[model samples]
Target: MRKTIALLAAAVMATPAAAQPTPGVRMPPEIGAAYGRLGKAMMAHDAAGVRSVWAEDFVVNSPNNEVLGREQVIAVMEQDFLDYKGFRKHITYVGQKPEVTVIMGYDTMVPIKGPGAGKQVMRPFTDVWAKRSQGWQLIARQATIAEAR
Candidate 1:
């Protein structure tokens, strides 16, 4: 009995952390859906679709270290300066309130334009979202490049 228990404990301990589900982190389905839309819009370079997900007063501290407003980011997308060949967001943290939610994560993407073109880049990001009559809209964001290869 002791030998069997010891082997079971060893097996569990040897499991990779990524194979385990994160505890106490419950991402609302609505937010997940919103992120899905954002990623799709970005990958397709659909400026209008991206605009609908952002608040009118949205702002972001970009990886370029510039604070940009909604229109500026949209313009970049419109110009195809923000084109991405592939994109994926990995949510690591979520802070939820009655009317707002803040999510932090890292995005991995291969941009087809801009400085990191043709390179896989990882950027850590934080996004603030507000619940409005229309739906959830992204109000603010901060993103910085963490790696590129």
Candidate 2:
């Protein structure tokens, strides 16, 4: 509940357009490396590997304005990998701390060949990952429809 409250406040406060990372600026090694691990895990459909990246009190303020908890978002993650031909992240900024990092980026999905191919997309995401004793665990996230460049 504490985490949820804090996350809600974060969502209300953040102005991501003003916060966009400059193009070509790299993310921190800690964040890029950790996200790389999670990316590989997703491609492999390893539920446990994916779960390891989430904090116990994870929360997401979704594009539709709905709030989701850890279990719910994990289920969504699993389903997304299963449903899409490929889903990938391109990180733009990674704000770091000894124990916390806020990662902001875009995500692309390549749908399985069909009427759906190249027909759908979701992008521009922000995720807050906290380094715990076990490792980097995602604590918060927000994502929205991709905007044309």
Q: Which candidate tops TM-score?
A: 1
lDDT of 1 at 116: 55
Error of 2 at 7 (Å): 20
lDDT scores for all predictions? Answer: 0.63, 0.58
Backbone clashes, candidate 2: 0
Looking at model 1, residue 18 earns an lDDT score of 20
- TM-scores for all candidates: the values are 0.79, 0.67
- Per-residue lDDT, model 1, residue 3, is 33
How many Å off is the CA of 98 in candidate 1? 0.7
In Å, residue 43's CA in model 2 sits off its true spot by 2.5
Name the lDDT of candidate 2.
0.58
lDDT by residue (tens digit), candidate 1, 19-133:
1113667777777777767666755777777777888998877544567677776665555455554566667788999899998776666756455568887776788899998
Cα error of candidate 1 at position 108, Å: 1.0
What is candidate 1's local distance difference test score?
0.63
Clashes of each: 0, 0
